[model samples]
Target: MPLITLQNVDYSIGGPLLLDNVELSIEPGERIALIGRNGAGKSTLLKLLSGDLRPDDGEVRVEGGVRVSRLEQEVPHGAEGDVFDVVAAGMGELGTWLAEYHHLSHAEHVDTDKLAAVQARIEAANGWSADQRVVETLTRLDLDGEQDFTGLSGGMKRRVLLARALVSAPDVLLLDEPTNHLDIEAIDWLEGFLKAWPGALVFITHDRRFLRALATRIVEIDRGQVTSWPGDWANYERRREERLNAEAQENARFDKLLAQEEVWIRQGIKARRVRDEGRVRRLKAMRVERAQRREQQGNVRMAVALGESSGKKVVEAREVSFDYGGKPMLKALDVTIMRGDRIGLIGPNGSGKTTLIKVLLGELAPTSGEVRLGTNLQVAYFDQYRATLREDWNALENVAEGRDFVEINGKRKHAIGYLQDFLFTPERARAPITRLSGGERNRLLLAKLFAQPSNLLVMDEPTNDLDVETLELLEELLGEYEGTLLLVSHDRDFLDNVVTSTLVMEGDGRVGEYVGGYSDWLRQAGPGQVIAGGGRGAAGVRNAAGVAQDTSSTASGGTGNAAAAAPQATAATAGNASAAPKRKLSYKDARELELLPARIEQLEATLEALAGEMNEPAFYQRDAAAIAAHGSRLGETQQALDAAYARWAELDG
Candidate 1:
């Protein structure tokens, strides 16, 4: 009855068994999220489901003729051709013929004879439906069919492969970290697209937001066992906590009993009696059980090393412009980045996030305009490329920098000791980085970066490949970091948690600064678009009290508060306005404006109270109906406050 089933499966590479007596099943129409700590065999389980790997023991069964497709974490090397050909290749032999036909038909040098022959083969094989599906998938993913696949960015290549997997129309789709290289826009789109898809989804991801949005069922791999958790992400968290606590208590009881048995068995005279022979056998079995037990993995102990304070102003830009490939990447940007400001940069892939970071940090010169950095700034940068790491060195060598010890916050710690805090054993720490997993590499990079203190921290796409626990720990670290942070991440939850303000690359080299993080930007800028440079809306990034609440750097000509600015400008240009004979406010209108401030304050207090209640963990545990009602009320109250702000601005102007 299941789409795929694994029964009493045992698998391992060399040492310890990666999976032991694992039993799991995939049902049609289920969105099962496979989650675990790094090296817990999540990907290995996916391969077993896809029939890419055979279990050493037990049976894996699939319903007759059900197709399975996979999107791997790493892009396959040497993938070639335009997007269409690569995607169509997912359909096997029929796909090959259709792809050949497509390339021949679209070539600059027309190959009519070859095209016709390939077309005849495709028709004979009845592959036209697969052909249409390929085109449709490309369009859905916003991939250009004629574009060269090898030339695409890593993020784009991932998308193309995803398209290829989707074009197969498999009943089961296994995606490993599907959100890995995608930008926020692509992530949002993928969430929506996957929700609309009809096939069963078994995905492994570290994106909490994406998991919360798409997972209909939760499955986790711990030790060597696969488990299915009931309910949503919130429910899973609560349930998992309960399970772990119970396991700990049970293990304690078992150990206590085992200790008593050992003491009894040590008696010199009574232990050898014939009457105690059964007791001796039972004790021997208990020893085997204890030896076979697997302990829980230790958590990553993360801490940030902060540097001395810098000048109040961190970096300031005036009419900054950058151009590459004869096109403007940044244009006329004015921003004053002050100390301790946590800023998030969001844009599509190839939208110049890295370049903008470089230009602002004075690492790369802008094609036009000026940037000034504050004095005494100790900057620590986390490159998304991990370029700072020498591939030739292992974790210890990389973090040590030719010394056995590293100083953290004026305290010296051995390099191996520090790596241990990140969950690396001495063996792993000394092993070449090429043998480490993606998550391990990310952890190593963090270890390297945090070894030294810095007044300014710049991280680009720092959330990729990290386990959920490690990711959350890093977020907690960044939250407490006493320094300016420039974070470039597509992770919605991470951005929301770490950044107080955002600078969005809207388009055409224009950057828009708004108060708050990704969700705030969404509420202000709508779903797919961003606020244009220097533009302020009535409710753009509004906080409690219906006032614009953003501490981000303002671009040139941008106004933070139009309501406050209108009155000041009016008084400053009184002479010019006198000749114009400005229209006067009616008595009723003036009275309304006078009362608006108090009304706005009341609404703000109500909004704050509601938000505070919802922010608590227990609030989300409430019934769905109650939570939905509160959310609806909050939205209504926000709308009313925004309307009041708009009215006040109109009267003042």
Candidate 2:
């Protein structure tokens, strides 16, 4: 039996159909990733699964006695409670029993039997350590247990809500954008937690790393229909591309056939004839089928035009330091930002990333030192708070404020036309900013920021609330960008895909630059080492005698090229090795190796056929559960093929 099932579900708001005839069945221990474009009903589907909303048609069913928990994007408003209390709320019945025991124990006449029953219930629920678990969850999410929830920052509140959802250890967990406000450490922790969770999990997240690490299956909602693929984000992307291509080919074939039928119908045989009337009916049916197939092939378009370039040295900071209330936020930091440098700023939350950006932009003066900007440096900043937008103004007004027109490629384009380039229709352009979804607002902000031609771009948490499509589009645009970029984002995949180097901000106000992506930074930092003011000594510097040398510096001010300046060992330091002769494979092993390539080729062909079948609109529109089973078989075949290749390589080597 499935843990949760949705059969022919239809959901709508106002008039437009958000979900139509969607069928899904989540089995036990399945990790499902729900993904779609913004406002495509991914969250609405999650809500339906959690019973927060009922389907307008069909049925949503959960197995008897199963518990479902959901973590929504919005934090509960007007809840005047501490973080601990809120998180403990997830305990449900056990929490009620615990509270009742406390109340009864304080009564003048102690009810011994009632207390014993409550204690027994707690033991049965396995909630004896519930308090400790709540505390631990809160700590991992970076929320103080004693802090008032209402007073917490938006990010902190989000953490608290996540903690509440996780503390209960429910049978089914549904999370919507769980990593929206998390830092690198917290996101890593949450990834591990979700991976180890022993239950059915469904979540909506744009973080590619998270999706790759935790999702065993991918469910996409496109054009009011649901299609599921069995695998992580990387596999889903490859398969989706293949599916789209196959669909295009199928459409082309249909078009060709329909054109021939149209030609036959135009021959003008009398409709009164039986054969001629039958041909007309068949032609009409073909036209309907062609239209349906075309609707399944919708596409999203994105293009970004990078601005002009600046001087070689775009920004330079000389021994910069910042202090707030006698506590240092940034130590003596000497950094040179060259043109075409894509730098990713990283650290724990509240580690002075924003402060450094402010200092660079000269919005705030450092306690000591100076920042210099190179010639013709036009910097465009994307603040995480969207502070530049006015809530009362419409989207067009917000984007076009203070300008009748904006220049693009040395040509003046009207504000409405510029807005259309960002996918905002005339109707949406006239909508108030406050009514826009988080993603729409983010897109509007991007449109406004990118409208001006700037040689340098500085963005803070730019990936928040963006769909996977937008993230991919942004990554492509940034890769093609000719100018310099400085970005602060917790999305590790984004950092790896977009940035050339990473700047680590230690919580103690020290900063260090490493030449590589986030994974490279982790490799150099090693186990249990915080990224602080240190050299790449652990990255392995060797002396003339072949001994590892420490080329570290104690000073806070250090350039990014620390590893480049380290001395190389001489040829004499190279160690001699005994050359072992290669051994031939045994008869059985040789025979198996000979057959492996054939088996691999056969599996590849099978996978290709399965992909083609999955791409067919009829296959998806017919039975989603059967298609998912086929996907699973496809994944299994792929794994087997990989193992066979590995064995063949081992024997051949």
Candidate 3:
């Protein structure tokens, strides 16, 4: 059954359409992902669906008596009750009724009127004991115990709220950025819960993995129009690519048509001196058609520019340790960031990725270590919120407020003009900062940041609210940036596509360095099968005879000429004694290292193919299995790469 329907809904603020003529009907058991760039009215639509707001020119109807609940991004943790009570409130009317029924059961309620009223209330609310529901929900959400939820951290508080919403068992669950504060373990728990959920769900989130894990359908809001895609996030991405390609083809065809029209217009005007009224009329008609064709929207382009800088180590930390309110976050960390290095600072959420960045920026002092900065380093920091602009200030004023710029080429251009290059139009330039969407504010801040010629950039969660297009632009900018970058983000695509190396802060407050992207780091440091005897037993390794093997061959005496003496081949492959013959890997061992690249390419292709299928509607019901398979395959490929890398390192290092 359709739980809710929006008929020609049009929402506006300050006379500008926020959502235009959006017609959508959501039924029970639909797990929908509401996706858009920041400021595309995704949250606004959720508000309207939740009955907290009304559309100016449309009707929103709820089917039957279906209830809706929204789990807000910023949860209120008042100084009132314990976390248990707070989460129990998600049960709404059922909870209230359960509490009243309990009171009636405990009291001496012999009065017939009181009994009838209590029974009526329970029946009206569908008569489920909220206490039992709360317990069940809390357990499923991993918030069952008092130890976990009562005296909690910020990350744990987020989990409690999510548990509360699930406990309510509403017809529709509306979640806004629910994964923002959760750690890896909690996120995994939530993912499993959502996978098994039986009700309708509409969630807006920045966690790509979470969205890919749970969303069965995707609804994208662009400009003011909502378009629905029938599969998961990856499917939406594929369809978006198809649409863009089609648009590009259509645009090319339109341009050719316009060129023909232009030639006709020129000739018609030239002949107008001797032509009749019909010729002029025909030219005008062609002109109108050309104008209509030219009405196609232009692509949004963003370019980031960085000034030249001396090639030097911009920031270095030696034995650095940090603590917050006496709890150690980062300990004995040694790191060096050089110019032009694109470094990813990754960890489970709350594992001090941000804290480490803050330490480097000198915003937070290290408890016990030295942080050295290059003499000529000019660092620009992008905060997580990127909401530093004043609410009342326009874009131009916001950009130029405290910065000083000199005239160039005898022309004085305000900071606003510079912003126009980043796609902030004249009308949007004067709009108040508060009216801008999250993505807009991020762009505005980025524009302001790049306008300054900073050599070292420290970005904290830079990809948080950015759309895929904007993120790609940022990736291109970072790729071409001449300065150093230290970015902290949970976005896997961002880390894998943008960064070259990673600095991971582990759960034990220790930091480690890895030579590649996030997935690479995860394979090397995360729990995986590591071959003994220096990558010898690892998968994908081969012997000289073209047999598939691992680095463990050297230890197991497997890499040898089948006719040659096993003891002799083992000794040759193992020791490097000064008096002994220079030990060499037999044909098999040598071939194993040589085949690493081909194996890596094969794994990459496998991952891509599996990712494509993971988004198919056929796999939505098997999301858990699909995710597990993908994760397993990813882990395997990463491990194989690691083993190959280790073998290569031994030879090259």
Candidate 4:
């Protein structure tokens, strides 16, 4: 039986129908990617499934005793707990028992029998090492367990909430934009974690790579209905396109018939016959249908016109180094940026990607070395934090602030006219900034930024909170942009689509330049590939294939591949080796590595059996405490298995 089902579900907020008579069923082990345009009720549907919201009409049913967990887009207000407390809350009844056990163990004059009973209960509930598991999860997400929730940044808080939802190991997990604040490594880790999940998983994300890698089914919320497609994001896109094309053709035929009917009605009949009356009614219905079709076909077009060209050398950084409080962030980085170069800056959070951008833009002076900007280098930067926007102003005022008109392609265009190009209607442009959806606000910011012409465009995290449609439009605009582009984004697909080269920041003050995109960089930096300088070669010159290119030749305008210098070996190995010896593994390490696969398989089988038992109708009728204990044990085992796999990967690498 399906774990959860939504039957004839209808929901609305203040006015328009968001979901109308939507039906859906989620089966075990199904990974569903919920996708839609902004404001398309994807979040609403997830809320309904998670029981966080009730539908105005129809029923949402869950199988008996099925557990559900959700990760909301916004962190709840007034959460006073620290990271550990918040994540542990997901443990539910098991957490209660664990707390009691701790209290009992510490109390003076405690009953010895009671203490022994509580100890057994702790073992049964898998609460013995719960704290360790929680800490591990926090570390993996780059969060500190002791950090106060109130003091955490918006992105950090979001990660905490995500960790909570994950630690719960629910039968059905509903996530809304789980990747919003995550870096590339965290996202990659989440992909692997979700793929190994044994329960029903449904999530909303704009990351194309995430959807393609994890989604077994795609559920799109469109036109007040939910449509399901089998397979990954690529399959869904192809099918959706075909479906839309067919609908467009059918609408064309309907329009022709309606036109004929209108002409016949204009001919003026003396008495209205039954057949004529029927044709008139059909024509009216066809008109309504056409209007709806037009609404469904709403598409936004984004265009960027290049401004005056800068010099051939747009930016040049020579041996740049930056440090914060004597801690090196960037060390001796040399890079040349030419006009029309599309470069993507990528690194983990707090790895100095932003600092490098500042150094290049001359916003911050490097501790050592120099930066040179070419003549007539008009730079327009889009801040990821949206710091330039005025909250008191409406969308129109925000975009049109400080000017009656803006110049685009050497033509003077009115402010409102420029706003219209970003899909903001006159009415919507008058709406307050607070009333706009995240995507709308982002679009408004883009409208304001792109209005002025610039030879160099710098954007940081531009894809955050943007719907897939808008993301695609932005990608298209960037592709056609005839200017120097410097972007920092975590979206792998977006980087692959828009950037020609990537600048990777490997922590501890090492930065590398690789030609092509993020994927190309990953391929070249894959396991067992030796890193030259801290993590990259000197001068950091790499070809499209990510092999080190001769920096001397490139600087002289010659295209030639440079052989990398080999590492020197110690005397013992260098003198007597017929072949380089492999690194010897300890006995315990070797045994564990050999047994990990079978152990993982055994754990998976055990987990599946536990889930089967918990789902049985009789399970709920049994002792509630016993059921809780089994569930907690299952969660613990899963965590253990995940750790084992992670360790194996690390050792193998």
Candidate 5:
């Protein structure tokens, strides 16, 4: 049976429909991703699912004994309660009844009628074992630790809320933007937890990585309509692009036919003294048959204009050290930025990407050395705090600053006309800045920023509030941009799509540069690379040797290249091969450590494949009998891979 169902649900505020005849259902153990542009009624749909808001029409039904838990973004943490206590609230209803039953049964003076009633209620609720269930649920959520939950950061607080929701063991769980504040580590942890979750899940999130990792099906909401696609986010994206392209072609064909028909009607009607009945009838039919063309194009493309390149050395840091509030964040860091460079700054949160940006921008003075900006470097910085715009100003005034002489289409244009290019309608242009949604605000800011010419662009989390269309636009612009760029973002899609070099920060202000995407950095950071370096011997080297070695290992592609860099082998001055007998590896030990990295890579490939399969609805239904068959293999593969990695770590230790 479906865990929850909604039929012909409609919601309206002041006669404007927010939700129009929307219907959806959730089944047991299903993981669904809900996606839509901002203000497309995603939050409203969640509210309806959780029973917080009743539909204006139609029915919402739940299977017998089904319960639901929803985490609302606006829901305050409620007075003075610690994190664990809040998660414990999910069991509040059950706990209350249990406590009441206990008190009544053990009361000093129990009335006969009350005693009978309490006993009956306790039997109905199975109240005797509620505490055990609550304790188990809390532990699963990782919230039962003795650490102070109230003092946890924003991401930690979100985890607590998730735990609280899970504590009830609800039949269906509704999550809204669950990963909005999470770092990469926390997201990976959440992904693991969700893989093992047995309940139905309906989550709304903009994190592409998280969606790809967890979602089994994609549900798109638009203009009061909801459609389900059979695949994960990536597949859904492909299908959407294909459909849009087809629609555009069909529309073009119709437009050409309509133009031909209009020309015939014009010539025919003018030649005849009066309109012919058949021609008029044909023209009317054509007019009636033609579909109304959608006036608004629902895409915001960022086109960044890169100014003329400056001489080399766009930005330079010399023995830079920085301390914030007397705590050292960076120590004697030296780096250089050159013209036309696309550099990505990455590190764990709180490692001071923002501080470094400030130092480069001359907003913060380094404690020791200095940061120098190249001569005539025009910088356009996208600050993370988007709310800095004046809330009272209209959108056009905010973007165009009342510029009436701006050249557009080879003629001077007004602020309203310029704003229209950014997708703000005439009515929307007059709307107050505060009335715009988060994505809208970000778009306005991007429009304003891109309109100005700059030699260097420094963007921090540029993808945060952008929709898919806007993000792709920015990606294209950044790719074509000839100016220098410094970016700080956790969005892997954005990083991989736009960046050429990575600047990673380690603890104690140490910085390292890796020349590829985040995945490349992860592979390099793995145990094999670390152990293989620093002149280790046969124990450290894997089977892949000679020409089979990865290019990333050495600057040159020669066997002598690897040996020349080895500090140990340079000691030929001391002895030949006969002087030191090579150690022999036992077959058992060799087998144990030999295939560890290969096994790990194989498991990663399998996991990615399984994730891709789960994203496909057609695959899930068409191969229902094979679900467990594939799932079990995946599980076994993962376990073996994990064991191999752990064993290798122990041996290497």
Candidate 6:
């Protein structure tokens, strides 16, 4: 039986219908990927299914007693609580009791009467088991129960919401843009978790990698209608193209017939008399049908204006190091960016990709290094915060900057007309900036950023809410761009498409520059070899020779010949291995000996975890860098375990 079904659904907001005569059903254990344009009512449809919104005209049927849960695209405002309380809210009245009990228990001055009442309610409802479920979910998602919900990072907050949704144990789940702010590591973990989820899933996402990984079927909403494409993404793309072409051909034929009929009727009185009555009536119907035809929305016409050519060396840094709050953000980095080179900056969040960009741009002075910028460099920065945009102004004013026209590639164009090229309607272009959605804000920013020519383009986390079509157009534009690009995006596919090489942060000021995109970096790094984001093995991982390898070495073939200056790790260091001898045991050493057995057990456990991670089916499916990072972590863990065992034996003997 279908978990949920919609029949003859007709829904509309004040204007045109968002959904008209739509029929759909969700089966058990199906992972459905919903797709559409930015304003195509994807989220609206999810709301209808989750019973958050009722269709103006239609019947939405669900299996009896089936529970539906949805994770909203935007986190709710004015939400206050600890992680446990927020997650527990998913459990209904029992959850309220649990949350109250937890709060009272943690208060500085406990109210005994209130605490006991809440505890009694929990006992009556057998809510302890439900509480345990919340804890397990939190742990699985790496959430701290006692942490303040508002104080967590964006990714962590989203994870908490997902945990809350999961704790409900709903029969059907709907997720809207679940990967918006997640880093690559968090995204990988989410993909793995959702793959094993038992309930039916219908999610809307702009992340192509996530869609391709978990979607069993693709469902698209367009022009007030719904269509389903069975099979994988590749299959959907091919068939969708064919369908669009055929639709165009049929529309063309109908229009041609309609035009001939109009010509016959428009002739003189004698010709009108000769025309058949039935044909005249048909022509009238054709005119109405033609007027009612809903044409496809226009694609975003995106293009970047190229400034004058820059010097060959765009940016150069020698032994650059940056420290923040007594911690090294970037250390001993030597890298050069040449013109026409597109470099990707990737790393775990807070691993210092932004810090590196700042240092290179001369926004922040490196602790000790010579920084040089090439001459005649016009730099355009697309900040993730949309800092370049003015909150008080509308789209046109933002781009126009009090001028009626803006020049693009030496051509003067009216600001409103230029905005139209990005698919913004005249009215929408003039609307307040706050009225725009996240995607709209992005488009507006792009329109403003690309208005002026620049030799160097730096975009940070730019793919946040863009639809797939827009993202593709942006990628196409970037491919043809003739400038140096330093892009920092969490979108793997975006990185693969636009970046020529990658600079990955491996914690502690270590940045490894690798050839190719994300997957390419993986392939080059191999298993356990390089940590793309200082998740593990940040200092350096050991190879078979027990020598720490330097992952930050530049691979040969960068435009600037960077490999020559970078030091590459070699087997030459194997001969330098030495261990300090232990001759005596002081009181401190005696205490250490007493704790060494348990420490060995801890090392063994770490090795087991490393092995388990590598054993997963999805482990090998990731790019080579991910596999290699884990492989290196595994190798390091095993080495530690071995050393611990040896030390234990030596002391015992």
All-Cα superposition RMSD per candidate:
7.9, 11.7, 11.7, 14.5, 10.6, 11.6
Candidate 6: Cα lDDT at 632: 60
lDDT of 4 by residue, 411-527 (tens): 788877778877788888888888988778788889878886788999998997788888988987897889999999989778877898999886678788887766556534523
Of 3 and 4, the candidate ranking higher by TM-score: 4
> TM-score, each model?
0.83, 0.74, 0.68, 0.76, 0.70, 0.82
Using lDDT as the measure, the top candidate is 1
lDDT of 2 by residue, 93-177 (tens): 7756654655566669988999888878888877778856776777776677667778876667777787788887678999999
Model 1 misplacement above 4 A? 108-113, 267-275, 526-609, 612-653
Report the C-alpha lDDT of model 3 over 27-132, residue by residue, as the tens digit: 7898899987766788899999999999999899998778788887666656234455576667666665554555455567466677679778777766656677
Displacement of the residue 477 alpha carbon in candidate 1, Å: 0.6
Residues 1-653, candidate 6: write the lDDT tens digits: 99999999999987789999999999999999999999889999999998989999989999998999899888878656899988998887888888888889989999999999889889988889998888888888888899999998788889999988899889998999999888877776677788789999999999887787778899999899999988766567768888999999999999999888878888999886677998878888999999999999889987788899999999999999998999988889999999999899987677788899999999999999888999999999998889889999999999999999988888898888999998899999999999998889999999999997899999998898899999989987887889999999888778867888999887667888887776556535533444545355422222210110122111101111111111122112222222334456778767777998788668666755654453343553565445546656655655565566555545543
Model 1 global lDDT (CA atoms, 0 to 1): 0.81
TM-score of 5: 0.70
- Global lDDT of each candidate: 0.81, 0.73, 0.66, 0.74, 0.66, 0.80
Q: How big is the positional error of residue 209 in model 5, measured in Å on the Cα after superposition?
A: 2.2
Which scores better on lDDT, 1 or 5? Answer: 1
Report how far off residue 234 is in candidate 3 (Å).
Answer: 4.5
Worst 10 residues of 5 by lDDT: 551-560
Better of 3 and 6 by lDDT: 6
Candidate 2: stretches off by over 4 Å: 14-16, 91-144, 153-155, 259-275, 286-309, 402-405, 526-653
For residues 343-439, what per-residue lDDT tens digits would candidate 1 score against the true structure?
9998778888888999999998999999999999999999878899999999899999899898898888989999999999999999998999989
Top TM-score model: 1
User: How many clashes in candidate 1?
Assistant: 0
